[model samples]
Target: MELDDLVEELRARADSARVSQERLGSLLDAVIAVSSDLELAEVLRRIVVAACELVDATYGALGVLGPSGEELVEFVTHGITEEQRAAIGPLPRGHGLLGMVIASPRAQRVPNIGQHPDSYGFPPNHPPMTSFLGAPVRIRDQVFGNLYLTDKRSAPEFSGDDEAVLSALAAAAGVAIENARLYEHSRTQQLWGEVLGDATQALLEGAAQEVVLADVTDAVCRLARADACFVALRQGSDVVVAAASGEGDPAEAPGEVLREPRIRAAMLGPAHIEPGAEGGTRAMLPLALGESPLGVLVAEWAREEPTDHVPHLELLGRSLAVSLGAASARTDRARSELLEDRDRIARDMHDNVIQRLFATGMSLQSAAPMSTPEVRAKLDRAVDELDAAISDIRHTIFALHRVPGGRPLSAEIATVCGDAAVTLGFSPELRMTGPLADVPEDVAAELLAVVREALSNAARHAAASMVNVVVEVADDVSVVVTDDGRGLPEGVSRSGLGNLARRAEGRGGSFSVEPGDGAGTRVHWRVPLASGDGPGT
Candidate 1:
């Protein structure tokens, strides 16, 4: 061998050695870059970018497998603009070449993607691609997803060295991904604990129910990373949205009844997930106390992927249920105390005060005969005044003895009217006559619902300047709501009107809506008190 030839061979070997060392160093740097981020989303993105940099690929993506391991639930892409992504349409679900990698869980190198037998072709707006490389990413012995690279920048096709580097990068990515998931889970649990504790604490401290409910919705929306969060509570036979927090208006707003049948049905079931009507995912957390469903906590996300906050949401719902039970118990205890006090006061008035007034009036009558004409007239007038006072006291005693089961009917009517005032821009004229306190508990509940629905209709649909609500209980209980607004429209939809009719019919009552005396509309609901049972028997 010649001396010159030997030196030339040594220099070539040195250059090859230097290239290998640089490649190894670059691979190490890529590994470190991916591991740096603890955020699961950010970590997935970095892994894709690092893989592309290591292999000099123009486009790269990491597809996270769904639970079934047959389809991709998340696709993290790099080197693709948002506009291009929009144009690409819906994401690919493990098919053709992609499915081949998912099924085989092995490295794939395709010189021309279109020429490959398993190629399924790209969507309409996808960028041109000829070469493709893919490798499985595994956590422990289980395949988590696939790493895909295409359009190798330095060469027409990726070399064997590129494939080897990507495989190694994917392995490291699995570890980073697992670590990020753990971190996120830990953070989520911690956040959930804090939110639950705060909500429970708020209730224990005697915070108003509305204030605490609002806080819970806000926290759930933020902690669950949901697009919206709301609580629906059972009110009478219907369900109402009690609190809501998020962007735009929720499907059901506070004070509004829930109209979705599916959600209503899910209220009786355990915690579960379902697809949203338009798109995305919905987590339903049923709030129940033993067998009775108190309500449901609904959290929605704009992404189709399943949420990881289901368990947390369930726990929160249970906490809310317990609080609800406590609140109900407190209310019951307060009502019992109030009723007891009222009973005692009535007994005192009837047993002593009324008796004394009756005796005094009788004495005045007896003395009237012995006085002079002028004195007799004065004594008779005084006796008559005493009789009026005794009669008034007797009526008061009767009212004190009457009980309307749950919340008082008058208080509920006032509340409903007050809430409507916010929307109506003015308060409704409320005239409740007769013995409203003597109405059966079930009948009172139905009557209050009628008043609420009527006021709600007037506030929302009627352009009324004045509204009047009159409730009278005689032989029959009657409710008349009148609004001085534009008369009912021709061919008006009957859905809401039908609900009113159904409620009345459920109580063996009659409901009617007609034109007012001159302008606006009038609603009348009447039920026979002695005809039969009241509401929910």
Candidate 2:
């Protein structure tokens, strides 16, 4: 041991110590950078970027494991162009070298990625890489995911120092991930409360059921960060979409039947999560009360992630179901009371007012025979006026008894035709057959509109001495209105006729106007009872 050699050794030792201190400072900076954001997605992304910078790697990625811990559910990458990614196609699924790190849960360094025996090789159009560095990120004792780096820039291959730094950064990532997740959960809960409160208040205030339901779906879509959401309610033996929100069109949903087995199963049983198109995820939550299955709430995400919020959504849907039941009961009770009050009024008008008017008319008629010729004529006219008044009262009573909300389909059709008689100078003959009560609400509504339009057209244009309206309900609903005045006129605007056709077509049905038995016009409209049924031409 010469003194000169000893001095040189000490100098080299000092340089090594300085380099270690600088690397330690860089590692601290990287940890702070990854922990700064409270957003889970941003945190995951920053962890990957920071790891790449710390190891001087040209490319980096973070692969979060799925629930089964056998595959990657999420892959966040950096240093790759969007075009390059698209060309590379589907993301890695923890195979070969990636799987080795996932299985070992320890730091790995390889001088040549392709030369390794476990290499799965790169996907087509994937950028070339020769070196790799990987580490496992753990939250407490559980391995959350794995981090991989390739093509180290500062050296031929990743050194032990680079591995040590990446391992440390991965540890800090675990803590950041746990914090971000807590924040996300808290935010989700707050949003859930907001949506529930709004829905309950709307129901309590007697908002329309459709309006409240739409609000619920919109709020849920935002809360779940979903691409689309909808609520499907059971209508008799059929399931119809009541409300929809998010990226899809809302108009296409309402009244449309849900035929998917997965959605139908959710309505009868518990919640379910299934794979979606283009690597997305779908969650179906059953909305029920006690033994009654009311509906289902479905949400879709464009990309499946490791985080799950199905339990929260299920709770929200269940609570909404209870609220809906309460609202429905309240509406029914109020309607019942109104109908009772109306019935009482109708009874009073018929019993007291009509009886008095009838008695007055009879007395006037009896007095007519006892008066002089002029006085007799005046008394007879007075009796006739009283009879007309009684007739008016009877019509009023009929209307009062048949309230708007509680009126049956048959009553509605009869009432419309009866009202049209005033304009037509004669009542249009109306005949209805089949289970009118079993028609779905939407179909019934469309049918009523068709009746009104047909009657109006007959009164205005047909100039017919006779008009007949026939409605039949079975596998489908059909409405046929005929007039005996004139056939389809030449060059007449078909806007009103077009409207009828559109309505029928919208419901998978058809409408047409043709010559009747003689010189008259026949307007025929037919629609299916349920969605997805073939057009009832």
Candidate 3:
């Protein structure tokens, strides 16, 4: 109550007030420093560091809750080295006192964290901690995360003043975090737009589908910070990697991932992220436009990596599917136009060219009968040439009328047999095996020629019914034509068979004709599925 004691008390209180003001000013500067950066990760790091310094705590961390609200998806820390982090193993999952703070969304101060009833002991190699202070960071009404400080250096425990300062820093941190997140979201949108725009422009410019797909994969991998990215297309009952970007074998990881029933189900359903091999994660996005399922897009990254961009990746996949649909439509339109042109040309040849040539041949034939011997010979030659021209025109018309898109080998064989049936009076039974529809065009063409020649011989020379044709396509392609005829005639020229054999030899294959099982003839032909040496070699 004395005047001197009163003066001393007021002076001490004034000193404390001045210190508080300085601390508040420093906190404001720290908030500005953190908010100045538009990057979400850098903002989070600065917040944690500033929080630790503001409260003079030995360790500080910011744990960002996942969408589920019970788990920490990201944990940024200050005062923990990389070695210490590795030694500490995985980050906490918002359990114990951390969960209390998250569940309550209020500031908490504890003298000894280990003595708390809900305390979950630290993991192996974690540093000792006794005092604890935590405050929830909220963006608007939603709790974004919690700022935690432990082991105050200057006091036995965190006082009310320390809690108040931490709470203020956490509030400022919330605003900074929201701003950084918005900036990051905008940056991500811009990046995705550039990627999709580039891919769309490339496709519209007539780039090959493979090249466009590669560019897309590359862009996605870079954006996601992924170790690899790949697109798998449905092939028969399975999926195969169509495009890939990164190191290691792209097919190996994606092939395994595609086999999972969950991932397979997602190919026609929704996009999802799942754990992958070797401590990694995979984000799968179905590449589809409406009801048409194109395939799936897969991106792989380390398990610890952030997956905030998964939704963007799915969006990219949808954009790519649209591009694919557009490209396919363009190709179909071009094919239809080419088919129409071919049909028009065939009609003209049949309706006009053939008739004119026929008239010319007839005139030449009539003149041959009325001319002298030398002149008659010349007229006969002219008539023969005109007749040959007419025959060639008719064959050209038949080719034009054949189905476009290169009919399947089985279908082409059936047509050849049907035409031969008109001459032989019976249809040949046909059998095929081993991916005949996937045969290369050049190889298929040669096989078709061989089949036609064999069938022609059967109709003209065999002179019997019950013909059988078997076509097998494996690593090697082979065809067998058999007929229940009297057998090879004696003293046959063999020149036609010689030509067929030479055709096979030129392509590293073989052709042979011999007597059939009982009273018929068998023509055997074989060729390598890919051009190279003969089978034995």
lDDT of 1 by residue, 241-304 (tens): 8888986255568888887887787789989999874788888888899999988988888874
The TM-score measured for candidate 3 stands at 0.71
Worst lDDT run of 10 residues, candidate 2, spans: 528-537
Cand. 3 Cα-lDDT? 0.81
lDDT of 3 by residue, 342-388 (tens): 89998899789988888887888878878899998787767656654
lDDT (10s digit) by residue, model 2, range 278-369? 88888878889987999998888888441467877878888899998999888889889988898899899988998988888788888888
Using TM-score as the yardstick, the better of models 1 and 3 is 3
- For model 1, the stretches where C-alpha displacement exceeds 4 angstroms are 1-21, 111-116, 122-125, 190-286, 295-310, 344-380, 390-537
Cα shift from native, residue 469, model 3 (Å): 8.8
- How big is the positional error of residue 162 in model 1, measured in Å on the Cα after superposition? 3.2
Q: TM-scores of all models? A: 0.63, 0.68, 0.71
User: Could you tell which candidate, 2 or 3, scores higher by TM-score?
Assistant: 3
- Cα lDDT of all candidates, in order? 0.84, 0.84, 0.81
